[model samples]
Target: MKELDCLFVYPGAPAGKKNLLPIMPAGLLAMAAYLERNSVSAAIISLPSALDGEFDLPGIIRERRVKLVCIPAHWHRQAGGALRLAEQLKRAVPGVRIALGGYTASRFAAEILKEHPAVDFVVRGDGELPLLKLLGSLGTGGRSLGRVPNLAWRGKEGVTLNRTSYAAGSATLTGLGLAGLRFVLNRRLTPRRGICFEDGMFTYVQARGCADNCSACGGGRDAQRRMCGRRGVALKSPASVVRDFAELAAMGIKEIQLPLNPLPSDAYYIALLKLLMKKKLRPVLKIELCGLPSGKLLKWLGRALGPESKITIFAGSGSEKIRRLNRGRFYTNAGLMAALRLASRLGVKAWTAFTTGLPFETRRDFLATAALVRRMRREFKIGRSGVYVFSLEPGSPLFEDPEKYGVTLRRRTLKDFLAQRGKYDMGYSTACFTEREIVRNLKFLEKTAR
Candidate 1:
C-alpha cells in the first residue's frame, strides 16, 4: 500500500480513562474527503477506538511513513487527550507534523501553538481550504506558512496567526464529499447516543454557520463571526442535500441525522423533504430543533419521513424566564408543549433535553425544569428525555463575559480545560448556585426525569 500523506486522528479522553461520548466530529470526515479529492491521501482514525483494540499507533505511523497527523480539538472535552496524543506521537514519530482544528481549537489557536510544542500547527475555522493550503505548503518545506489563511503556526520567534478569512460557502459544501465511510467502517468506532452500529446511523451536515445566538453555544452566530468570519448561514441547495441523502442510502446508511435545524426559513427543509419524497428515499431521518417547530412544519416532516422519524429539541430551561435570560430563541413552555402534542399526534418520536445549571437558574428554576420533565412524561409519549448540566463552552457569551451572565469561570484557559479529563464538571458556577448545588440539582432532576 502507498504511504499516506496525512492522517486525521480524532482524540478522546486522556490515557487510562474512558470518554463519556466517543463520537468523532462529522466535519473531520468531510475534510478528509476534501483532502482526498484534492489528490491528498488522508484517512481518519479514532484514537480511543484504535487504542481500545490495542492497535499499534507508532508502528502504523512508521509503516505508513505518514508526513502529517491532524487531530481535532473541536470539543473542549478532547483537549487533554488531543495534547497527550500529540506529545506521544511526537515522541514516537519525531519527523511527523501535527495540526489541530475545530471550534475549540480555533478559539485558542495561538495559545495552543505557544504552549504545546508538539503541535506544529493549528488550523482555524472551516479547515478544508486552510488545511489543503497548509498541506501544499508542507510539501514544499513550509516556506509559505504565513500565506495559509485561518492558520496559526509555531514560528522561530513565536506563534504566528494568519488571516481569519476562510468561511466555507454553499458551493464548496455542495462539491465536497461529505461521507467518508470507507475509513471508519473497519475501526471499532462507537455509535453516537441513541444510535447503534447495526442501525447504520450517520450525521449529515447540510449547512455551515448558525442563525441563532444561544448564549451558551460555541457554534452560535456571534461565535462564528468572531472565530470563522461567517456573517450569515451558508446552506446547501435542497437538490444537493437530496443527492447526499441518496448517496448515503445507496451506501446502506439506514438512519441520517440532520443535526442542525435549517436556518433563514422553513422553506429549505420543506424543499428538501419534497425532493426526498419525490425520490422515494425513506431512510430514518432525525432532525434536531434549536427551537420549537410549528405545527405545519411538523406535519410536513411527518409526511416526508413517516412514523419512524424523530426530532431532538434542546429546551435549555423549562422556566420561560430562565430561558429568556439564557438568550436563545425565545419560546414559551406552552409553545413547546404544543409542538410536542403535534409531534405525538403525527406519531413522530420526540426527544427533549433540558439543562439544569443555566446561568440564572435558581433552586426554584431547576425544580421547574424537573417538574416540566415530569409533566412531559405524563402528557406525552416522548422517545427519550434528560436534564444535563450546562458546561461553559469556549467562545460562548458566558465564557467571554462571565460577569455579564452572573457566571464565575472555573476553566478559562486551554490548560484549565485540559485538567477536566475523566470528569463531568460544570466548569462554571452561576450566581444562584455553587458547583455542589448544581450537581445536587442535577441528581434530583435525573431521578425526577426518570
Candidate 2:
C-alpha cells in the first residue's frame, strides 16, 4: 500500500558452501551509493546473510514498503534463487514491482520475461545511472519504463525489449560525494569510528573493459562489447584512484581489491602506488592480474605498500601453455616465479588461482597446474592457493567459439547455470573434463598442494 522507492536485493552466496566469501558486493553498492546522492531512499537486503539467519529479508521488505524490489541476476548461479526471491516478494506485496538486473538477467531478459511472470522489469548493463532514471520514471508514472535504457519489461501486447545500453565509466565513481558501500546489508548503517579492515573488504572496479584476451573470461574486451556494450578499457585517473583508496583506508578498511588487467601501464600503477605510499595507505592491497606479474610492477607495489602492508597478487596457473590458452599470458613459469620471489622478498603474499577444468586441458595439464602451486608453496611463501573449475559462462570467448578452443558447450541456458550454482566450481564435471578426470585431478591436487 506504501511506496518506499527502491530496494536492492543481493541474492546471496549460491548453493555450494555455507561460508561467506570475504568480498563486498561492489556493483550493487555503487548503484545504492549513486541513488543516495540523487536523493532516493533505498534499502538493501543481502540474502546470503538472511539465508544464514543473520537477518530476516521478508521483514525488511515489509518495513521498507519499497515500490520496487531489485534483485541482481549477475552471476548465472544466482538466477534461480533470485527469481525465487522475486516470486516470494511479489506474493508478500503483490502491488510492489519486482525487477532483475546484472549479467545473467541482462543476457536472458527476454527469456526471463517470457518464462517468469512475477519479474516486472529486467535492468541490463550497468545499473548505476540507469537505476536513477528508472526510479525517477517510476515516481512520475510507470509508462516511461521503455524510455529507460537497457531495460526489458512487459507491455500490453507482449514483452518489450530495449536495445542494451551502457552508461557511466570508471570516472563516474569520482563524482560520488561519499562512498556508501556499507549498506550492502539490511541492518541500519551505524557510523563506524574509523576504517575496520575486516568490516571493509570491498571490490574496487579499477577499469571497465578488460584489455586482455583471456579466451575463457567474460570480462574480456570482446565479451565487454558483446555483453556490457563497452569498447576499450576505460580507466579512472590515477589521482581519483588514490583519493578513493586513501578515503577507504582512512575509514579503516584493511583490505581493498582492484580488478585490473595487468593494472594499466607500469607507469600508471607506479604512480598510484607512490601516491598511496605518500598518503600512508596501509590496507592489504589485493591485485588481480590478468597476466604474469612484472618485476618493476612488483617492486613499485612493494614500495607503495611499505613493508607492513600485506600484498596479494592473484595470478593464474603455473603451466605456461595452459596459462596462455586459458588466460592469454605470454610469460613462462620462470618469470612468474621470479616475480613471486621478488614479492616474497618484499613481504608480498602471492595469491595464485588454478582452474582445474578448462578447454583443451587434460590430466597432464591439471598436474602441471598442481606442480606449479607446490613449487610456489615450497620456494615462495604463498598466502593461499586453490584449484577452481572453469564454468563455461554464456558470454565468454570459449562459450562463443568452443570448437576453436577445443571444448564443447554443455551449459548454455539460464536454467543450466542455475542448476549448477555452487557446483560450477568443482562439485560437478563440465563438458571439457569428465567427472572421473575431475575427481582424479582434485585428489591429485589435494595431495600435491597439501
Best by lDDT: 1
Residue-by-residue lDDT tens digits, candidate 1, 1-450: 578878887767777776764667777777877888888888887755454565566877889888788988888887777888999999988988999988888999999988889999998888888888998998899999999999899888889889889888888777775545565523444444311232345777778888888779888888988977777887878888888878777766768878767373667777888888899987798888887777777888888886778888888888899999885677899889888888888877888888877888887888789889999988864425787876778999889888888989999998888777444576888899888888888888888778
| Model 2 Cα lDDT, one tens digit per residue, 230-337 | 666666777788888777666565566666553335676777887777777766677666566677878887776745444444455556777777775567777767
Clashes of each: 0, 3
* Per-candidate RMSD, Å: 2.6, 3.8
lDDT of all predictions, in order shown? 0.80, 0.67
CA lDDT, candidate 2, residue 47: 52
Please list the residue runs of candidate 1 whose C-alpha ends up more than 4 Å from where it truly belongs after superposition: 51-55, 183-200, 262-264, 381-384, 421-423
In model 2, what are the clashing residue pairs, if there are any?
A: 195-251, 195-252, 197-254
Give TM per candidate.
0.92, 0.86
Candidate 1: Cα lDDT at 347:
78
